[model samples]
Target chain A: MENTITSIFDMNIKPEYLFIHLDAVDNMDAIKQMAVNLAKQGVVKNSFIPAVLERERIFSTGLQFDETGIAIPHTDTQHINSSAISIAILKKPVTFQAMGMPDSKVNVEIIFMLAIKTAHGHIKFLQTLMNQLQNKVILHNLINSTSKKLLINNFKSLFNKEN
Target chain B: MKKILVACGAGVCTSTAVLNKLKSILDDRGFKGKYELSQCKVAEVPAKSSGYDLCIATTTVSEVKCPFIMGIPFLTGRGLDDVIKKILKELEK
Candidate 1:
């Protein structure tokens, strides 16, 4: 329902981001709690958990890449301030529902949380990110990134057209 | 002619996204055929008496019986290759 225009080509998202190094989270319940806590603290705003749960009520965000419990929870842009993204790294790993794989669970340790600001422009952001996700090289870099700075720089570089 | 049914919670938001993806994939494959797109609730798939060539449902269905292509990654790529293949197969039919 949001009408804001945050574009991937506009370079709206930056490395100045907020994140929770889930060096200890072990379950989806905890993941939900961290997101809820951020929402409560005004770090993410009111729509984070609602949007996440709602989209998930439809489907899951778990991508189960590398079979190491990593996934992304990207909701609609209605609950966004801008094109800000948050990353959550779980220490113990958690099981999340997969797209069509019902009985099988996708493990999630790393979450590239997307907070898009527009109803339409988010499609482009998703395409860009998903392209990288489909690439083994970029996925490996993301999985190996240890610091926030590293994650930011690498992602920015990937999105940086000249890179 | 084969049909691909797109279903979602309300048949509005994400179904639209999936529709966009299907259009692009079909166009890219150089196939010439019109696809039948039906948006419905997750609970409404079976009751509809249409033998769609392929069903692209964005969410989980209880006991629905059809070849369903999940759209979780119509928004991403990891789940997109198979989706493209399914749509292409339907187009070839």
Candidate 2:
């Protein structure tokens, strides 16, 4: 069995989980695709997909930034096996109900699907990611990165500076 | 000290982000040591809200005993000043 102690500290974002120029029909399609991929990677349980979909419906994750929009979709900790952040740069923007305002809509070009295994364990990473998201230059670079490798490099660099 | 509750869908991601941002904002605005922030799932708001002086959530919540503020501004950096003013106003009351 994988050492539980080591696994708990190994929640770094995996490159395989990063998707660039990903093609999806809509918000649900994007989330389902990412959730399914995370499940295959053993980062989340098979039940994560349905739970995330249901959660997204009730509490939308669409955040509209100054220059672009992004969505962070996630579910309960019970559906996750380990902690990971799966990022998708959509080939085309998809409509998602705005966070805290279901009546409004946002065309999200980036998706950050969070598979958190514990309640408060990943707060530092989450805070850093939020601060990065608030930076227009970083958000632009993330959306325009031509390749998955480039995107992951840029993404990792953002966190590297913080730590 | 004022008790502020920050909540999101799962209480893990967005709420954590909002809580940290809120804390820094409060600290910068000289609200240090004046309040305590707690994170929880949106589903747990109604039950946990009464103990708080304010409830800020990334999603819609109902039946909250304290004043409710939408925390999406903290994530998007839009209207954050207004939200902070609102939070300070609530904390003052």
Tell me what fraction of the real C-alpha contacts between chains A and B each candidate also makes: 0.20, 0.84
The prediction achieving the highest TM-score against the true structure is 2
Please report, as a value between 0 and 1, the fraction of native contacts recovered by candidate 2: 0.84
- Per-residue lDDT tens digits for candidate 2, residues B5-61, read 999888888888889888988999899999999999899999999999999999899
lDDT of 1 by residue, A26-134 (tens): 4455556656755654446676786676666456656655435455565655565555666665555677776545666777656766655554454445556655666
Question: What is candidate 1's TM-score against the reference?
Answer: 0.69
Expressed as tens digits, the lDDT of each residue in A1-163 for candidate 2 is 1212222133556667878888999999999999999999888999999999999998888989987889999989999988888899999999999998979999999999988888877767888888888999999998898876787778877787777
Question: Over 4 Å off in model 2, which ranges?
Answer: A1-10
> DockQ of each candidate's interface versus the true one?
0.32, 0.82
**Per-candidate interface C-alpha RMSD?**
4.4, 1.0
Q: For candidate 2, report its TM-score.
A: 0.93
What docking tier does model 1 reach? acceptable
